[model samples]
Target: MSARNPGTKLDLQWVSKVRVNTQAVLKRAQQIQGLKTPKKQWQAAWLLKAVTCIDLTTLAGDDTPSNVHRLCLKAVQPIRCDLLKSMDMHNKGVTTAAVCVYPARVPDAVKSLKAANSSLPVASVATGFPAGQTPLETRLQEVRLAVSDGAAEIDIVINRTLAITGQWEALYDEICQFRQACGDAHMKTILAIGELGTFTNVYKASLVAMMAGSDFIKTSTGKETVNATYPVAIVMVRAIRDYYLSTDTSTESLLWLALIKEELGDDWLHPHLFRLEILSSDSLQIYHGTSLSYVSH
Candidate 1:
């Protein structure tokens, strides 16, 4: 994977001017979802593409090492061998983009993947994940610990209080520190849009994260009452486009846009640039035409 340069110097004036028109965002999202659906082989191809970009996740309080091990196995071979054979994808090096887990479980995930001889990167949620209410020093330490424990990627949640209170500069500085702590590990900054309470705030927070050099700007930690939504995703992706245009760098942006393939093309769907967190097996089944046998950890 190519390295994404960390964003330098927060553009406060530009951030302050960011706005989201609810009606326009909603309309565009609806239109994108209504694009012509790919059928038969095309549908299967797109679903397989979707599977490759998924961050097969298991974020639960009751998670155990055994379950995490099984999750890693599933990540190595997401679809059953029979299904892959039937689709002629059995030996195509198909695998989920990464395995996400809590900071404490990073070692377990790494051990499991190593035992399986799979090199899938383990992504650990850190820095008071899902809430991020802890002190800055503690959060930075959490990031460093996860990286030390064999995590190749650190998913750090931003302080929503900073965004809600319009403390853009403080949020940018804090995230930059967290990025530094990550060292060589990729940093995925989770904005937790559900808690941000407005699309505009989500846009601003997305900009702040990218400016601070987040390798990926994730929509949620999957802990909030509302996780990922279309309107919120639209706002975030637009912010990503804006940042890309302004800097002309190869930064990545992720969204679940299976139907809007024409507009996004194959390049935008790469795991390095975009990721779709599969929240449910049912959604996977709907796309793949077979029941996902593996249970969520």
Candidate 2:
């Protein structure tokens, strides 16, 4: 929701020179792994913070207006009223950051949010989501249509073929096209890191996504065999920090708030700059004082 990235031109030299030390990345991640979760009051506070940053989502082949409408309702009041009241947060306008759905379901989300009188943005996943193998023209049009349908945000999945094949220029050009097609809608580029195959590839892809005007470079589609693991996220946030220092444009941090606080500092913790894309409702079952592992998905 900040200003657009206004991406730089393709700098093959910067992309080519990057090298990630896999062993080093793994060790750093291990340090985070060994840490303990916060105590009750702090845990409650962090969970509430996480609630405000959630991108309440439903991206299923069976998705319909009915389901999307329900999703919007939940986004408006994500937690039980009593729980929030107990925390004295009932007066706060605590809703998820946005409601994400497939492109065709954008209007459904728009209508539902309007009926609820909530101003939360509707985000759509476009550009042949999950597996972005569609033709370039088709993918670009998907983004345009989503924006026209009242989606304030667009989550796009980059073509793995482009990243894996080392087509940095092509990848940059493609994301640039997505950025252009997005118009005023903020763009969150999904790198689909699990399929990219290496920490080095993930780092390079993150840099290229930022360089190509991605407002946020995300970890996975949540449909991958592996989605949002700690090591991959460590590499991605480090890339975001690197991009910020070099270009003065900051892409949002990775999944873990603690990790964001540690690597990017407190500035990146704000909701406008960072987001947590929660595709499943089960992840929000924390009103019962559940373990933190529930959201580790």
Candidate with the greatest TM-score versus the true structure? 2
Off by over 4 Å in 2: 248-255, 281-297
Shift of residue 242 alpha carbon in model 1, Å: 0.6
In model 1, residue pairs whose N, Cα or C atoms come closer than 3 Å (at least 3 residues apart or on different chains), thus clashing, are 7-213
In each prediction, how many residue pairs overlap at the backbone (N, C-alpha, C within less than 3 A)?
A: 1, 0
- List of clashing residue pairs for candidate 2: none
For all predictions, the C-alpha RMSD in Å is 6.6, 6.2
Score candidate 1 by lDDT.
0.78
Model 1 TM-score, all chains together: 0.90
**Once superposed on the true structure, which residue ranges of model 1 sit more than 4 Å away at CA?**
250-255, 259-264, 279-297
**What TM-score would every model get versus the actual structure?**
0.90, 0.92
Error of 1 at 183 (Å): 0.6
